[model samples]
Target: MAESVKAPKTVKVASTAGSAAGSGAAKAASKKKVKGGVINVAVMTLAAGLIATMAIPAYAFNPQGADAAQFKASAIDGMKKAQSQSVEVPETVAASAVARDAASATTEEQLAAAKAAEAARQRAAVSLASYASSYSGPSVSDFLANPPYPNFSLDQVFSVAQQYIGTPYVFGGSTPAGFDCSGYIMFVYAQFGISLPHSVSGQAALGKRISIEDAVPGDVVIMPGHDGFYAGNGNIMDAPDTGRSISIRPIWTSNYYIVRLGI
Candidate 1:
């Protein structure tokens, strides 16, 4: 009598269907959580991309290009201010920079000019020193300064030569106030428009070469005793040798000659 128990087939089928529905609900919930995790990752990625976009501009404008970055920032600020106030900014800023550059250039040019002037002064001093060294020794106007006679005329020069009778003898004198042997002759004849050599032997070689026999009143007379203008009285006035004054002396050497100073 105890073995007659039987289960309902519809009730068993309903329990299996109910278990399957519960499993499906659990799978759906897991899929939704996974999808939500993916969405959060994508949001983080978007946020990171946005941060990179902003940081790249900041890195490019770092210390290496600080001046240019500051200028750009100022320009943007200026433009913004200008837009707010309806004014101009580019021309005023550009003009200020140009003025500063011009002032710096002018100062540099002034310094260069001063240096050039100093260089020119040094060159002028050197040239003047060179000129003083080339002309040395007594001049040739000694004998012509004082003629021995009152009747001597410079031949062909059409002029009477007489000056400096008692001038003191000096070592290198060329003035009427004092006379050197060659310098006295040089000083006297220069007043009469005569260009004579500064040396004794050199003066005797001027004009047409002539012998003592052809000597005249205005003839240049040379002798070993001394050179002078020959007076008809046979005496000559000459700035004599060192420690001696100009005097008239007889021509005694074989080196005596007469030189015509002009044609």
Candidate 2:
């Protein structure tokens, strides 16, 4: 009975609700700590990645290494090979170049020939001038006194006149060296003892006016300010202007009539 009475003494025990509430509070605290730790780890990882990127050199991402150098060398070599390659010229293009060269050469040759011909003409003119300037032939007085073709016919007079065909023209000259228009007539007729004036009008008046058709080769051709020997067939033989030799040529004008000297 005494043991039973000692066990009946009251014992202090905790409530279920308080225990559950305390357990919930501790669980919330643990969750909060775990979330904070996860956030800290993520922050540290981002900081380490930023530091690593900053530590790297900018050239690390560039492709300018040995491969780029080899590509540049290959490009340069290709350019050199292209420059050294020989391109064949087309036959048509080559022939065109040759033809152009030949044409240029021919033009040069033609120019040279023309220059030579002009020089020759000038030389001939100079020779004639020199021969006229240095002449020492018979004078008009000597020729008149001697009268080489005395009693000569008109044909003989013309034949004698032809001997001085190549004589040069000179102003107011009547010798064999050079002769003017009227002076030539005077000198020629002097050989046949025919006294004539050394003037166009005077000589024209001393002869008979004749038609051109009826004129002979020895007849005188009288123009407005000129006169010559009628060479028949509308031609005349006379000393022309300055720088020209005595020659036979066609009558240049229709304003002229024939004159028979011994009419």
Candidate 3:
């Protein structure tokens, strides 16, 4: 803060003329000295007013919230901070964008897998169609003599069966190139619009029971954990197991039961 300056005091001095009624010259000298004292007081009052104007703060009279320089600096700093923030992204927002990209990639992969599965199903249908009409075998009427059912031909079973004659046995596989015993059975029957579960015991329960003594073509010959399609003359076309070929071979066991696939 600026220091308060004190104004010098103006003192009035008496004339010391020779006497009160001395002469006219003496009175004139007294009046001249009085005017000089008044002039000195005026000069001193003006100087004091000038000093007070320079020393007093503007806030002491009409105050303001902020000075111009301080306000300008604050504004400039705020603008610089905003500019720096505009070019950067928050970590949370960046992570959300990456998550969306990963989700999109996973959806595309699932779509591709679905398309491949559909394509495989269509090719299997085509292969079955090519063999459907090639076999000429006993009709369903032969094995289902006592039942009142339609006489559907069994040729389709044998036709589809023959196509996989040399296909290697593959555990849990049902494709034409390879199959397990029950897998082979289910694959062939599927062409004739039969749905079978991929299990040996499951296959044994799917058809009408027939004694091996009265068995005919299209009968299911089920053993302990194996099964095959009954070819006429006691032959069976089947995928034996892993590391074997599907073939029309003789019934290898009498410890078996027969089940006719359809009436």
Best-matching candidate per lDDT: 2
lDDT of 2 by residue, 144-246 (tens): 7898877768898789889989887876778877788998999888887788999999999999998877888889999988999988788999988767889
Shift in Å, residue 234, candidate 3 = 2.0
lDDT of 3 at 202: 91
What are the lDDT figures for the candidates, one per model?
0.61, 0.82, 0.71
Ranking by lDDT: 2, 3, 1
* TM-score for each predicted model, relative to the true structure: 0.37, 0.49, 0.42
Q: Backbone clash tally for model 1?
A: 11
lDDT of 1 by residue, 1-263 (tens): 57877788988999999999999999999999999999999999999999987765432656687656655655456457667855567987989999988877757668899898777556534533442354363334433464333343465222333345565555555665456566666665665556677777777777677766666665667765346666544556666644455666666565566666644
Tell me how many residue pairs clash in candidate 2: 0
TM-score: which candidate is best?
Answer: 2
lDDT of 3 by residue, 1-263 (tens): 89997654431112334333476777888999999999999999999999998766433343563455344445447457657844688999999999989877757779899998787666555544543444344322322343222334576566657877898666666666567788788767765656677888998888888777788777788889999988878788888854478888998777888887755
User: If ranked by TM-score, best first, what sequence of candidates would result?
Assistant: 2, 3, 1
Number of clashes recorded per candidate: 11, 0, 0
**Alpha-carbon runs more than 4 Å astray in model 2:** 1-133
Write down the TM-score for model 3: 0.42
